[model samples]
Target chain A: MFFLRRSLATSATADALAIESDSGSPAKEFKIMSGVILSRPPIITPEQTAFSKAYYHYQSELYKRMSWTFPYWFYYPKGTLAENEYTRVQPKLNEKDPDVLFNRDRNSKQDVVFPPRSVQRETEESARIYAKIVPNPRTTIADEENNIRSLERKLDRTLYLIVKRDGESLEWSFPATTIESGENLESSSTRMLAQYGGEDMNIFLVSGTPALYYKDVYESDGKYEGAKIFYLKSRIFNGLFKPQKESGIVDYAWLTKEELSSYLDKQYWRKVAGALSKQ
Target chain B: MAFFKPSFGTDLRRQSTAFFQCRSLHSSAPQFKSPVSIVHPVHHRVRYKKSILHPKYQTLLTIPKWDPRSHLFKPQAVQPSRVKTHWETTLAPDLMLANYSHNELKLRGRKHQEWDGSSPYHVNRPLRSPAGNAMATPDILPRTFRTVPFVTSIWVNTFNHRAVTEHAERNIPSTVMIQQITGVKPAPAYSGVSIMQWRLRKERNVGAVVEIKGAKKDQFLATLVEVVMPRVKDFQGIANSSGDKFGNISFGLDPEGVRLFPEIEGNPDLWSGITGLNITFVTTAQTDPEARLLLSSLGVPFYGRERFHNVPNLDGTKQTRKKGVVYYENSQE
Candidate 1:
């Protein structure tokens, strides 16, 4: 049964695990670390291109035309004052006219205009339903100020959490910590995340399995020949990162994929790029 | 009056016989049983048209399904879908992340075991019915991009007892109501069993069922979530224990709840004498929890205690939230 158990995963990390000893010596004992790629997915739909906007508008118009006709008789019964008022505003189509052929062709392109009801006549529910609503601006204060640390910025792209360690001079990396003896990747990553990033958060680890692993070797050292770091995916649904002063994290940033590339080392970016979502 | 009387009865008898081309019915008349005419199966293409086989269609050897040249082509309505757009932009990634399992193994459901072949009798014996369970549940396929849970279709049906007790045509209003809502005509359902107490017989028309797919399915879901559900008085969220062993979930709405639907609400008079609606959501998810997750993300709330399956979170724990559980939060920060 143990031999029959075949892993369903064909992940790049799984393949990387096989090639670990290919670089380092067979007897080399490597240090294991756990890292989390805490990310905030897009809040809004990506900004539409001009072509997409025009196309959607065209499609919407066509869709409206194909939709069911507004039943004037249902709402405004025949010979009622409301029905008379509704019909009076619209152009009367003559079936005998050359332009008008089918019943659908008559006023199908235009929406039925209805007479406005007096505020006094309207019920509170009807008034609430009919009230106009305006949407807030897409760009927030964080975006306006170009605040990389704030989660509010980049409303339409996947923003990742990268931290600057106290000792590291220029290296900005995903929150990671060395694995203690006998500790697994997921538990270590969760501990590292809450310690480095603040515990005041509702972030979820995507999976217990590590998404990617990075290995480095020190040829001069015999006892511990290399270091192995495994990255786990996590998502911050709600909450802000307050860097723990005791955790030795100097600074933190919430960045999109393109921005992360500039802050992360080129070699590290190559390994981590595939793990993050494009959007 | 006897025809032998040679009076007005004789004239009526002759006329009746001439028209009927059979002996007149009387107390002494031998009963006549008409022979049934049997027609053999005919060899012909149903609704066939010779013009379709013309040379004009020669260029359509590999025409796409949406192409006019294809025989099965239906013009796809280009509507700006709200749910689909939301799914692509937001829900899809979130679900993928939420559903991610650590090296997930495809779970095999109950299946019939092979014969042990220990004896001659066992060699050819029919496979034993699936070891523990009588029914075979579907395999729980590992989550992948293509296999992510989505609403395939929505089945909305309502049975009217009046159709069976009264005339079969009494179900027309329900049929029309469903058609108005779905834009697709529903097929009539029939009674499967005879019930003497209810005056129900086999083959009796019971009600109608409408299955809306693609864009219409999403529209109906959107309407239910946004408009109808909120208007239903004293409405509790869908109960936790509602799904079939498979991924499909069903819930019933009272007649009042049905009346709240915009199609019927617009003209209550037209949709009169209707019963409650039983709505089922068919999803691609392999299990109930996954299907619930998909629906909950789409703004369908669920209530009651639920045992979550493998919802591993940070802090090295598997958590479940009972009461009204919301899978998605569209909080703008």
Candidate 2:
């Protein structure tokens, strides 16, 4: 009887172990519970509690003064209404060629026609791309080994294509450009190189998500206007490059990481370095 | 006199016999000299004899102290003179060799003594080598390992009221609200460009703003996550897709939602009108997923999909309709 009981206990323990290993459901539940249990308890001051009571009273009074209306179509799936509207009016809008609408702003009497603010204004709908072009890999075994050795030694040596901005003063920067509407990141980067880089260059997209930059255009009256820049990376398979003067690139040079530091600010260089190292 | 002399002889004989017995006992018993010998009393040593196999085995297996063959396993003794000039005799001569074969063999192995593309371990060989052409191989991007999420700063802004009328009401309440919420005095924001529609003029003070950082930022976030957000009615989690693709996520709160804060809710008389606020969480994470994970770990809820319900359409057809309720995954479940 003792042996029988011992066997039963061992089997039960084994079954428990099997259940623990076989199914992830229990573990997931435990994780969620742990997350909540591990969080620090909130501390509320007496004054805060009093304030909340007063706020609730104020909100009640405000509610009495105003009647609320529920938003229409809150439960409808996305694109249903837009699809219906598009089917109804698309033919008429298309006949006129919608591209003309953009040009009409140029002829409008108003000097500046600000685009209508989007309902969601936190992030831009359109994504930007930034590219870092690296030199081709060495072909010979010895050269490759040397490259590896240098990298192991933390002796980073790479050439960066820096362009001179044609502004109030000549400011040096990497070959970066904003992605145009209807064009993808890779194509935009290639076009930017062709236009500003000055020379025929072959390049391919390097793996990794683009680095993001938030440039605050203006900050006034508690309103902030900003642009998001997505930085990407690419390797120049073949290219003979020169800086173009017509594109505001008066001068250009292949500079090492250390040399690039002297030309670019710390923040700007950090972004460039991030894209390069991502390769 | 004869009797006394006879007794003295007998006494002498007895004394000699006792002395001879003492000598015999002393010679028979083992004498110990070393301090450790105290542990092995003479009687104990006699009872347990030393095993003959122990010393025989030890002698057969033990390597000699000065054997050069054992130098690989044991540490080599360094002479002060040799240590001072060994680099000149060894390292310099190895370095001076034109081919570097000796150094290569020592550093790598015999297999890598000669430069061959097919060497099992080449310095430049890609880790987990790809099955195709080497030149066509993709480069490995560096991974930046970030451990903790930190709030860099919090920015609060309000709009300009000058465009409504010449006697347009100034946004004093908003400025006071920001000050009350942040516990810091707000600075006036100026317009950089002139916009005719909004009647915004360049260099005109349009709104008030306050930037909170360090410990104050932590306090504000605690209030936001623990006190304010949970109290919001019909509150769904922040959209999972929200973020600047980078680590920063920016979300806006309506005037109604902003009113839930204790700072705003506590003072009924101080509130004049509704003022909206934009809160941006800046994290050290490089990607949106990482940032969202970090935020969720901090107790900020995120909604997966918007909740939907069945409703009758205008044409008397039953249709599936969405409700304002966002389906939030109860992470604590």
Candidate 3:
């Protein structure tokens, strides 16, 4: 115990610094920030090229032709309502006519034919089953007006949220916030987003770790170190963005990757090009 | 693949007599584009160029589908698949970022060891098994762009007790049921061991098994997640601890649940006592937790206590248990 005490005394040596810290140097201090790259995924299937359309058609045709003939008796028994409807609608092929080929050699047509409904009032299930479906228009009002803030503008491509700060001279960038002393990048980003972005939006941060990071330099009153921003990926499933008046966010717009290049500065876009989705 | 790839294929190996009843020698219409001509009973034997069979091509009797010069070579990706598009456009980037670890260490997999070679008997001896009762688990490789998980294939199986106790032909429905659901022909499953209590003999047909991959596998998954699972009454979802540690997550559907499939649901009367179906999603992930994450992201729900220990905890404590070490945590916390 006496030897240990002596050793401890000898080690202001090991535990304490031998020299004083230099406080007079003018080294820059970087301000850490977390940037959220919030994006809305495609809501609809993308338009196919001519080659793909033709290929799908050809494949479907091939499948239809190669498949075995459908078992008609299984669905339409001897004297069922479906059988009656089938018999009434579809006529039997004449055996005498050699030119009539669909029934004789190959039964390529396998789809069941239902009798046109006019005389009989069908049940709710049957009516719903045979109801003619009318799909909504692909282009919405948002697309026509060229609304950049509208989430519904681009239905097929991923749309990212870019914001302009309160000042008029400020540049366009993704929603970003300065990290607090004890806060991590993800939590700080989420907190800033919720504080300004309002509770209307339902967002899911993709991960805890940042996907990417960007470094910068600043010269204000002195040669100051600019912000070192870490980008965290997030996705908005469904909701509207309510930009707060006092939250320093002047305006916000949802833009595709292609449109982002034109809105954002060349330097900023260069650093962000790798993280943004092309589609 | 053989059907669509072959440009001039003679798939007339099994021509029904009724199909060949037409008394004409004229060729049929352009029914299937791949087949150049259909063989008739009149000309039962097909004649072809004898040069293909010659020893010139290094005696590669099998058709070289990869060779561009061969008729079997088909240009791939003629049509854009919905599943493929989703993976590329929406799923891939998000998954990569979500599964990324800030600081992960690469672990060496426990491999088979060699003898010290000190004795003379070690000359031609085989490598020894891994140490202890634990299996040679795969290396916990850090997640990277290329290491992201995906479903490689799906194993669909159905075992019928009637096939063993009753006549062996009872497994016919099982085979047909498996084929109907999977859209792929299945192979018969035979019992390896004889059970006296069950009256099952070795080599007896017990079930049917099919491994679905490529396009059909995606299609089956889509149907299961979208239509079948939603229709299942009071379903509790797949159990959280369902994987076999080797990244293959398996689950079974009761006969009623199996019948809920659109393929089987259409005609339930025909399949009165259909056996339950067991589906195993074989994935590229090396561990169970990673496999579970991939599956859950792909729309499969997990219920019960989720033990995501197989995957390296990135967000939370990140205290990964070392090999041969017992982990303890106070429940009071």
Candidate 4:
């Protein structure tokens, strides 16, 4: 496996070495070399291939619908704040003048204090109301979560601060699962497991030009619900490459054997038929 | 006595050969059954069906009867016979030969559909949003009782005639005559609009307050009433008119008003050119919590310049504050 260092400097620092010859003679004995040959390339299983394709397809579909922004602001009409209504404004460290606050007591002289004509921070009630119109991320995150996932539990969006090679600021969002999964996202193998279900189950992953599938029968509820197989499928052109997208299938339960029996059995049920026919 | 000893020697020679033959037969039995035991489910089904259909034929055709002297055919039990056949086939020189390939090919196709829907999406169908016509509301519902101090201007660029020409031939809307004259689409016609510019403030204010010192307060108020207010209403509950494409919109303080207000322009610390405007409403119904949450979740940037409470310098320290969103989660009182 190739280790991908976040920076070129770190990559340069790492080295692998091997000693090829053990001869003791002076001229013949001396060559120390660096570099390791991988005995085998990491095998890309059919399931892994299917999973990555499905994920990319889902991402592309989401990117198309990303253009629209939500509308849900509270209405505050015109002429709410009076024209001359003002209050004691707070000043920066250097801008602070103790005389400005004390000089404007109601009993002393004027109810409203007016300092020099120089502008200070205008903490107007209208500005506050206007500022409120800004969208809060916490609420958006919550709303976005509910719109997607089927489970009641929320998917945590953890951000990783990263700087691009060009020195641009960047952040990455790691998809969330149950907290029990683990805290260190870097070590979480669940990401791979989540994409492609377990092995030892009857499954065939097809990867080429889209139509990807992740089919595995696990035990969910009492009556072999988990064994009920599911496949995540999307066309390459329609989902991954299409400029427009309509919707996504986040979570879907597998059909029971009885339910599957009603439909004319086609190609997908090869393994299913083999297992059931044995019985 | 010598003749009796000669008979014993003859019997011993014959017994030795028989014993060696029996050992050879015992060793072969286990080797034969090993292959049948490891058959995949597909192979098992094929054997099961074949055995049930033609049992009598196998019994009469192969192998000798149990009686050693008779030398007649004896029927073997299906299980034992299958076990023997499995081993024979497995150990054969041509073991890798394809026997059930035709059957396997047919099964593979069946597996594809069950795993994922192989059918293509019906592209010709009309696009329908899952949420349908439901509109979003702010997370923290704006307080009607709380007096607003400034006017909140939301710019809605419903349809751009210039952009439409590329997709399909169309003329600019009659309202965009100003956009053509100035070569600048008025703030109302800009594609992206955010209400968070007003929502992030600690104090309540009005857009009208900022307009007071501007060049034309009368014209500004007219724009607020005639153009801005209608767009806000359109967002709140836009009637299903034939022309409404439901395009992008933004909410912020009027740039004109922000520039004119001396307090905003003079304070470099408080406002970094980002302005605010308050929205005032006349409402009778109790504000719904869901509506508030919806509005709070509007296209406010959780990151970037438009996040709530991320004043360019709110704490009065000169530190450059990064922008982030405040998720308003009101208690379920």
Candidate 5:
């Protein structure tokens, strides 16, 4: 019993030391220190292989829906502030003159105090592609990646469209839609853009990637239990932003990054940062 | 008449004897026959009053003869009972006359409706009535009064004396403690005011605070109400007067009370010294009473006026009621 206890204690200490050493030292150093030994790889069973395949399959499906990429437009324009066009000239008074001192009371009574004009912060000119995730089951991972690469190559030539909601506040969001049956990711994205930005607008995919993955549990018990959104970056090749009213878009703005930051939430900024960091 | 009434001792003995006799009789015998059988008499019947019809009035039987040639044929315009006043025509006319236009009043109302003190957009304007006069009236019912009050946020503030004493002692432990208790990261609180004697400087890191909301707030409140509060010794419940006028209530807990929390007590090694916590509960109730009611429903016990003292009657007689202790005398005995 004493020998068994000693062996157990040694094994526990070894495990703890192994964990500590694993974190502190590099794997190569640890291997060299421990004296490297070559051994045959363990034989994997058919069941294990199948289980791993199934796990990957589930992960790929989640990846397809969750991964999103949007084009980051970085445009900073340098320009002097427009002179206060509404500034009015005031009558000057000389403090050294005796007459000015005699008329001080009258001047004080005639003083008309106008509220100070609000100072507007100068903003930089930059634009961002408001891309949303639209999952396409038909498109393979390789095909999606290839499409995004193709889109990235055409980024400079494309003119992206902005969609806005028709309301007092003029809320804006990206043109996003789910991939319909038999539609690929590229086609679905183009369709959503065309539907919101009008068919006249010559829009092309600038770049596309599974940039952001957001899990949305719309219904817990339904067949489509949850949805993953994949954001794809796109830009307009040529055409003006003519918002389709039928699709609930009333207005659009070609704003800079600074201006866009004021309009978008913190989450959007975080997403932008993530996309930019990848680049 | 006083002498005729039985003495107290004799009356007690009589009642006791009667009770014992009744008990003894029940134990002495079990009757074969059924006891207290209820009977219905065959002749018993309920007779409702019969209604008698009366002749209709002569005037009701005949309709007035219509004459096309009469002056009644010419329709006369009826005057309106209530005229549209200027006050009715304009939306909140008194407010408009007082330089508060309809737009301004609406803006203020909207601001108040969405007012959560933690938000930077909250405007600190006094609540006013439709007449443009500041509403000094207490307990004004909100337009959207709900049965259940919503907890806006739970703010936890604590000053770390250990940090002050040992400059090397950072707020790491305090931050960890707060995180463990609230399940959210705590923000470091800086001293806004400086005190020369206390060696405190403005913007000096003195403590940490965490504002909990949503599901986490509910969970923290449940732990506070169910586990921590019950374990505290000599707890007389929270006072009703501990609230800001705008339905926010802040209460301080001593080091002992803080120690009573399961998170702190369960893992003593995790926390070396107990720090007093000031927990402020921001609620959506307009008045203190409403907030108190809301908190009480959420399992926070409140101390009533009678909780502390047993006052004498106006006649200078000693009241039988005792403070802090409940007595239940068995009347059967």
Candidate 6:
């Protein structure tokens, strides 16, 4: 009996040592719940470029609240109502010929409207282009496109600020869009970035819900109609009021994956990230 | 035999034995009967019964010996050494001790006065004195109150008076008193105010008025610890409502009635307009002249400053700053 007990103890000790020295990757890796994939050097064709310009001009009339010396223009489908849905409208739109305006006056396009020039160079240049990001293998093509566009907006802001600081000018070409199935969105974005521009660009993958919830009623003297009561169902989720379920509010807030973790929300995003990592 | 004086210096062991023997025998006749009982004398035998001595009295009974080492005392050696050793052998030998001297001193110095060293472990206790008492001093210091200047602007509320009152009362105090008090808990400051202005479709020359009634003079002053003055949302030329209307809280002087809190006699505008109030209480004096003078001059009217409201257009078009407070309008493409 003594020998048997001794043998068991030694085996248990060996197992513990093996576990300690295994050097396998951490049982779980850090993952953001909301996945944001970024890409650049957008898959812009000549036709798409014309559409983008037309769409930009059309929306600018309403949202811009101002007219520029150089006319603001964009293309959109004839009947679309959404203000910023340029991608939806651009492909099916047309523009009045610039020839009419030019013939009426007589000035070159560059002479009529020139972008800000760099002191160091005659013309502005793009900093870099073409980035791809793969969020999770399960990420849908629609969601990936949305995330990429959002990332593009963020990058635009950042680069604008950077280039402006260096006393340089910048302009971005129309971003290209495509749906690659069952591929890594992040790695794909990176590869695209490398091919079109270069890989020195800062890349990030973020997972988050796109919605933000604020206590509008609390802030706005109860005049805010959007505030809805939410009932706590369990640790992972809350059920919003039935009346508000259709108001595009699934949770009290739309948070990035990191924020969800900080908020002690479910580790659903981590699982998604893990599945993505396998892919 | 030679006559010899007793030296009185005997072996400690022998003296204790002899002294105890005489006392045990006289204590009681029954106790002397047994050798074991006599040697070990039953506890509480009361060989010499006397009243119990207090600790101070007992301590006083023993005199400290005078030794030459008293002059050699040094404070550095008086502190105990704090070296720790690992008997479990789990910790590494080369691991440096976490030098916690600064932390210990900080904790000890910051400890509240009520913390008693008698307990083996320290427990948090409420401060015996007011939290501010630590900074109170007999010396008089300059009393200053900071006021944030606000531009005249209109506020639109889609709710009625009751909802407005409840909401304003909840959020206003923190914004109001953040400059003065610490740890402000929500209370009933909002209960006293009567909401006077309610317009659904935007009226002319009509302003929102919040009147705090029966307010103890310094009560409002107490709320301004870390005041957050709301930014005036800018709009174009004339608001849908005039400067006389919209949102501005008037105190001491009513929106309709003009009384200057006995501090001002010359300034006529004191009866109306947006005036910021900030004053420190040395001992709650009701009347301050400078505060009144400052408040009275607020609505003197910004003459010629109206031209600055126009935003220059890039297309050589005149884009005037319109009336009413503007919300965020991002022109992002």
Any residue pairs clashing in model 2, and if so which? A75-B321, A75-B322, A75-B323, A76-B322, A130-A230, A130-A232, A221-B206, A221-B207, A222-B158
lDDT of 2 by residue, A44-84 (tens): 11122576566656544433323222111222224775334
Minimal lDDT window, size 10, model 5 chain B = B78-87
Identify the runs in model 1 with alpha carbons over 4 angstroms from their true place.
A1-28, A63-70, A92-110, A180-187, A216-226, B1-65, B68-77, B89-143, B162-170, B180-184, B226-236, B259-274, B303-333
Off by over 4 Å in 6: A1-279, B1-122, B129-333
For each candidate in turn, the TM-score is 0.71, 0.28, 0.77, 0.15, 0.29, 0.13
lDDT tens digits, residue span A1-279, model 5: 001011111121111222233466532211100100001111111122576666656545443323221111111112312222211322345455423332232222223222233345323321121233564444345344543222222221211223466643455444455555555444566776666657775643422223234433433332343344455444344555565767677665443334445655566455543432110
Using lDDT as the measure, which candidate wins? 3
Cα error, candidate 2, residue A94 (Å): 83
Per-residue lDDT of A79-182 in model 6, one digit per residue for the tens? Answer: 55422443233222124433333112222112222233234543332322112344433334534454422222221111100000111112211111121333
lDDT of 6 by residue, B1-333 (tens): 223232333443454465566565565543332222224445332232233345745544454433213333212211111111110111111010110011111111112346555775556655454233442212111222211112222111111233343444333422322211221222322223433564222222122223221122123322221121111223121122222211232222121111222122222432223223322222111112112212222211111221111111222333322232111222111
Cα TM-score of candidate 6? 0.13
Model 5 whole-model lDDT (C-alpha atoms):
0.46
For candidate 4, report its TM-score.
0.15
lDDT, candidate 1, B1-333, per-residue tens: 211222334454564455456555754332221111123433222233546557887667568776645765543445556788777756776676567655566756666788777888997688887755466555666777766788899998988988887888889888877887777769987778999999989877899998998888888999999998888898888988888746788999888988888878866765668688889999987667778888988989888755443232222333332221212121111
lDDT of 2 by residue, B1-333 (tens): 112222334464664456555654575322321111225344332223346337765654476754534322322221112211222322222111211111111111112122356775766664542222122212111222222334467777766464223323466667767877876679876667888877667777666778876556666777888888898888887886687544677777778888988877744555767677777888664345445655664567877632211110112233321122112222121
Residue A239 miss distance in model 3 (angstroms): 1.9
Worst 10 residues of 3 chain A by lDDT: A1-10
Per-residue C-alpha lDDT of model 4 across residues B1-333, encoded as one tens digit per residue? 112222334354554445545554686532222122233443221123355347676644454464323336221121112212221322111111111011111111001112133446634444442232333222322222231112223222223333322322222332232232122234332323434633322221111121121112223434444444444422332111111111112234343433334333333343332323432221121122211212222211111212112111212333321111121222112
The candidate 4 chain B region of ten consecutive residues with least summed lDDT is B93-102
Write the residue-wise lDDT of candidate 3 on B1-333 in tens digits: 133333232354223332455444445512322232443423213344546647876435565876545545544443556776787888878777666664666756666789999999999998877766455667767878887878999999988998777787888888988888887889998788988999988887899999998788888998999988888888878997698766899999889888878888866776756999989999987666668777877789888865544444333433335442212231111
Per model, how many backbone clashes are there?
Answer: 0, 9, 0, 70, 17, 54
